[model samples]
Target: MDPQTEGHTGLGDWTPEALGAGRVLPVVSAPEAVLSRDGAEVDPIADETVRLAADLVATMRVSPGCVGLAAPQVGVGARVFAVDVTGHAKAVTVHGTFVLCNARVVEASRWKVGREGCMSVPDLTGDVKRASRLVVEGALPGSGQVVRLTTDGFEARALQHEIDHCAGLLFLDRVAGAHAIYQRKVYL
Candidate 1:
């Protein structure tokens, strides 16, 4: 269950486990909905957003300690994402699958870098600066529950990082130069 196994292709075909654990993650959105250089909407959320979010949760368990996932890791470019802050599945209030549509970062703090790893860019990790707290807004799956969340600590950082992936940004982009980069020390 070493997610950072060198040369390993992520969770691969691992079986889905728990509410947010599995493999074969969904790659939602085309290249059309991403934001352009001027911050214009290019790739918007679609049917794939929901599908990807479900699969991501399924794949998280196989991900070896994953608590969150983003569409881009699956190769999608939509502003969609999902997360389960509670580390243990039974203790997870949001244990079930979640899908986000047209998500946005409403607020953030100039916090220090947090250790990060990526499913797409596996076998590596680094110190990446992210907001200490985040105010995120998005539409929920099926219920269409518009969620406005204020999250902090690992939960907040993980969510914001994944959302950035949905927006075509990578944790590497926020590494704050070489001084902050590092290799993965451990993987479950």
Candidate 2:
């Protein structure tokens, strides 16, 4: 792990070098078996897990408008993911870039329907209901330190979205009905 990222107190310092300079891995599309099965819980400090975390962040950065990504999206069935909602229009509490492992929602409230799309399901978007306020518990990629993250609005939604990916769920699985789904009009 890069000391600059590991020693930094802020979440924004994350860079590809932090995890041994992770490379951008190809994202697998929907219907792929890896995206349908729950990801395996991973050791936060494992070499492979750290590398995957780095790669996830690297991949998310390259994808336009993508605020989060999961291991399964890259065909790795591990409960690891990356998120960075820094400058999103709807973001309320940005954490910059960070990776979490085996994350679980500990608290959720203020539900509302929001439009969501995924790299794995590039052709569609859906109005899925998610909590606007949330608390998640998970371990950090390199430190193996468990953390309780409190966030709301878009950041919360993004976390839930990526968490769902780790659990083998697509936004398509959360929509109220077919009518709630729409063809993605914008590529970005």
Off by over 4 Å in 2: 1-17
Residue 72 lDDT (model 1): 56
Instruction: Compute each candidate's TM-score over C-alphas.
Output: 0.68, 0.91
- Overall lDDT per candidate, in order of appearance: 0.57, 0.88
The positional error of residue 120 in candidate 2, measured at the CA in angstroms, is 0.4
| Residue-by-residue lDDT tens digits, candidate 2, 79-120 | 999999998999979877889999899899999999999999
Root-mean-square deviation of each candidate, in angstroms?
11.5, 4.4
Candidate whose TM-score is highest = 2
lDDT (Cα, tens digit) per residue for candidate 1, span 155-187: 667777777776676677678787877776763
Report the lDDT of model 2 for residue 14: 38
- Candidate 1 total steric clashes: 13
